[model samples]
Target: MTSDTAATAATPAAAKSPRALARARRRHSAVRFWRAYRTHKAGLIGLGTLVVIALAALFAPLLVGADAQSVTDAPGEAMRAPTGEFPLGTDQFGRDLLALLVWGARISLTVGLLAAFLSVAIGTVVGITAGHFRGWYATVIMRVTDWFLVMPTLVLAIALASVMDRSLWTIVVAIGVTTWPTTARLVRAQTLAVESRPYIERAQALGGGHGHIMTRHVLPNVMPLVLAQTTLVISSAILTEATLAFLGLGDPTVVSWGGLLQDAREAGAVSAGDWWYLAPPGIAIAVVALAFTLCGRAVESVLNPRLGVTR
Candidate 1:
């Protein structure tokens, strides 16, 4: 009975050892990644900017009351320039520009993140499938990807948005479906390279099924490219969302950076010389896009030192 109890305890500890090792390895990799990431000043700055923006968006309600968003209860005059009473001034609707910006960040960032994730998920799966398989299967997938690649992504997104019910999710889906081809192309190339490695053949020799080989070997090898592409995709997603919103396809009920720009245009902020109304959202969009680009470049450099060296 004592021996059986000891064996049972040992079995659980042995089972836990793999998980504990995996956790330790992940921590070590994260530390290494951070250490390398610290060397890129521009990347660090961009990352800091994103972190600040994310925190502000997350805590927007705490920072500004909901009344700030209420046009009927607006506390300031319409199109007022930045003043002590209202730091960013008021919008055309007499709503506080500062508050609008804070809330807009939440929508913009959420759409960007979710849309990018959807795009990458679809791309990764398609890329893996196309690269892992051969014959007609690979040909069909590649042809479809090529078709999307040749087509104007913005036009596709616009068409999709035009037909859908105007909502946040509609915008996300439009951007996600239209933008995945680029990532698919990228990931397919990486998968092809990974599958060509000797270990993939060894896995095949060991009787690894297609699913096991793809998930365990091909996916892991291609993940670095996927990670790098994700940052770039996010930037594109945000830009697409803004474009759709500017064209009056965005959710009318929600405040977003692009919606603010559209509102500014409708109110004739440019004609009236209300730079305050026009500048904040435009600047925010540009700054966030640039920040994501900077971060993507940094991640690419970290993952592929050869690119860094060439640069």
Candidate 2:
């Protein structure tokens, strides 16, 4: 073939080479991850439960229609026991227990996911910085992480929540800030491991800048661990928000699992034997938390083969 003919032929092959190979590898890895996750019974159950809860939260208004927003205790409905029309019974305020719980799922899940995202974001930045730099910055970052580690998370969250305005965002911020240290430590460990690898050394030798290397090389390698940690963090964040709300620091206007518990407590449900009002929200919290925990553990097992946890 002539020079121009050969060059034209090579262009098509080269155009599909690296990008195609990279995409294939990504697809293969995703398939492998899914295969592993699917075999995990607890993980599947957790994922299913979460999906159901998420669907419920998304369609809560539709589920209960206008009654979801209506005050239930207005006339004859106040503190009524579970019956055909009102499945889960009525709260002291006569709100349908089922409706409240459904709506509460939206608030609870929103706070959980968003707060966890915030925690993960902060943790990833700090961890990546500390792991890549390995100097004074590293020292400062790890020391701060350790300090947060030493403090009681719940107590610190309470103190932080107390200082902030009692709102959903305040609850989210309080939970997120207090919860990031664990994630930071986890990410820092993974980053250190990735930073020391041969590929990373090669990237450094090629004069790749810190930002580029950290984002491209280190971040991708540590993402599996970060993802597993994020699942666990979501569960923790939910519980923490609930705790803060139960302690009377939660936003009063917003309905949430924690708020439900708070209302139940304040209504003397414990003394009145109102199992209908209290059990649903508490059970919802436990089930959702358990779901996340199971899925997180499965992901951790999949990512870290050394654990050798059987599906």
Candidates' C-alpha lDDT:
0.91, 0.89
Candidate 1 segments exceeding 4 Å error: 1-16, 309-311
Q: Give per-residue lDDT, candidate 2, residue 141.
A: 80
RMSD of 2: 2.7
Per-residue lDDT value at 244 in model 1: 93
Candidate 2 C-alpha lDDT tens digits along 79-125: 78999878999888777888889999999999999999999989988
**Residue by residue across 198-271, what tens digits does model 1's lDDT show?**
99899899999999989999998889899999999999999999989999999999999999999999999989
For candidate 2, give the lDDT: 0.89
TM-score of each: 0.93, 0.92
Q: How many residue pairs clash in each candidate?
A: 0, 2
Model 1 local distance difference test score: 0.91
